[model samples]
Target: MSGNRSQVIIQSKRPPLSSAAPVKVTTPSSVNYHFTRQCNYKCGFCFHTAITSFVLPIEEAKRGLRLLKEAGMKKINFSGGEPFLQQKGAFLGELVQYCKQELQLPSVSIVSNGSMIKEAWFQKYGEFVDILAISCDSFDEQTNQTIGRAQRGKSHVENLYKIQSWCKKYRVAFKINSVINTFNVHEDMTENITGLNPVRWKVFQCLLIEGENTGENSLREAEKFVITDQEFQDFLDRHQSIKCLVPESNQKMRFLDCRAGRKDPSKSILDVGVQEAIKFSGFDEKMFFKRGGKYVWSKADMKLSW
Candidate 1:
């Protein structure tokens, strides 16, 4: 989880609005689309686990992107159990290209495990991508394996470096996302993170969603991964030298009220329209901005030397 995670009770029924009262509108400014829930890595604290193998057809997915762009969406982030899992990254590449090329969104990005990405995928879709955030929870090989963040034989850290190099070669701004959990809370990542020198290092506190990781219907048991706030803070203090660090606390991530013990399904934007579908999202625009969610996200505007 790259961002903060929090749980809140959402009122299932609200009083009817007066005919004269204006309907509440939530802008689709920066949207994280969990297009697919299937991932290769079995991270113990993964809130969005593989519950289904379904992926929306490419053309239909594009149609929804167009609707979001029309509804004032500036950034479109493609996330998943693993986005690159579909068609060996072609599905994600197409969406990234469409959002940047056709829809002309300011920012198009993906959050992936970094193991499935190959040079070929970036070769075709690199130019259109603004950012690529890779999830790397620990630099220690054994710790990563214990946390289920590693493939049987491949080194997750080495793969991370290879992906970082690809990001630089492709001119895509690189970012690192680490979920601080009990296993790697004490590991000093200062040396490794400084060596990578990503544009941003997003440090997230391990979070548990009701039906995703903790409740009866959950797929993963995340209680073992949970760390105290003080532990998370100590880890942050240790990495004070990393200038690009961005910390996200579980409490600060309350923009969305994930009530129903899981992410409640709403009518597809393709069928009901972006405006109608987004109302059910319960997005707090003010809190999003307050959390430093907006920044210089466009690659062209970043002015970095490729």
Candidate 2:
């Protein structure tokens, strides 16, 4: 599935931005929040499990929304195991509408795989949303089949094209994101994607996190999908016309740069187990630990007190 499918929210309420905000989002900045761990595609470069698990209960989400509204947060980004897959998306859509009409919070956005975003999903929330990020790694049919999204019948390339076309018909702006691994690291791939249309292209560098980043893991049947540096560089050179939207606040949106996970066990959030690690975002990032193979937030990882 798509990695970093986490939705980030604006910390304050303001007029909707017709264009992106000043690129440089700095520390103490709250940009994205992971909504659910459930996803359809298992991409090479992913970090969903490291951030969240299960869906945020509807009641809990309501409370979260109340908090956001009180805090004056206007814009909220929706993401998921295909955000449209949520059991009762209308509630989420309603939340967006509340922000748009009642609170007049600028705009809401959703990032999805676009497998089958039925008319109901968009009709109910499209007006409230600013954009829909459709994941399109490559325009190659073989590549889509190899990437494990083949069972969906239609080629990933065809689905992506349809999404772009529909967005145009609906008068919505869309962006395209791709994660790079050692497998598809060859040139001419991204170039092919850019050659078609002037879409926003996002390239993610593969990270060595959880399970296996290098060696081999039985879980990852598509290990050959890793993209190489030279291939990536050549494609970037060829597609100079494409817009690269690397967020200033997050270079690695889905994958955290945990280089320490390589040499030391304590450096990685996943390595320390969900139970014993520190928890961030209202909880201590280090307080997460594993119990019965489940990662749960146990205690707060409090820093030294003055």
Best by TM-score: 1
Where model 2 places Cα greater than 4 Å from the true spot, the runs are 1-30, 49-53, 69-74, 88-92, 187-199, 211-231, 244-255, 258-306
lDDT of 2 by residue, 1-306 (tens): 112322332222123344567542212112233466566676544544333345655655545544554444444566655566666566557655765676555545567777757666666676666556777666676776665544456777767777776665554555676665454545455455554342345565544444434434323433355445565565556656555443211222222433433211222122332223212222212211111111110111111121
Score candidate 2 by lDDT: 0.48
Q: In angstroms, how far off is 89's CA in candidate 1?
A: 0.9
Backbone clashes under 3 angstroms, per model: 0, 34
Q: Report residue 53 deviation for candidate 2 (angstroms).
A: 6.1
Please tell me which predicted candidate would have the highest lDDT against the true structure.
1
Per-model TM values vs. the true structure: 0.91, 0.64
Candidate 2 residue 93 C-alpha distance from true site, Å = 2.6
Candidate 2, run of 10 with poorest lDDT: 290-299
Candidate 2 global TM-score: 0.64
**Lowest lDDT 10-mer window, candidate 1?**
1-10
- The Cα error of candidate 1 at residue 191, in Å, is 0.8
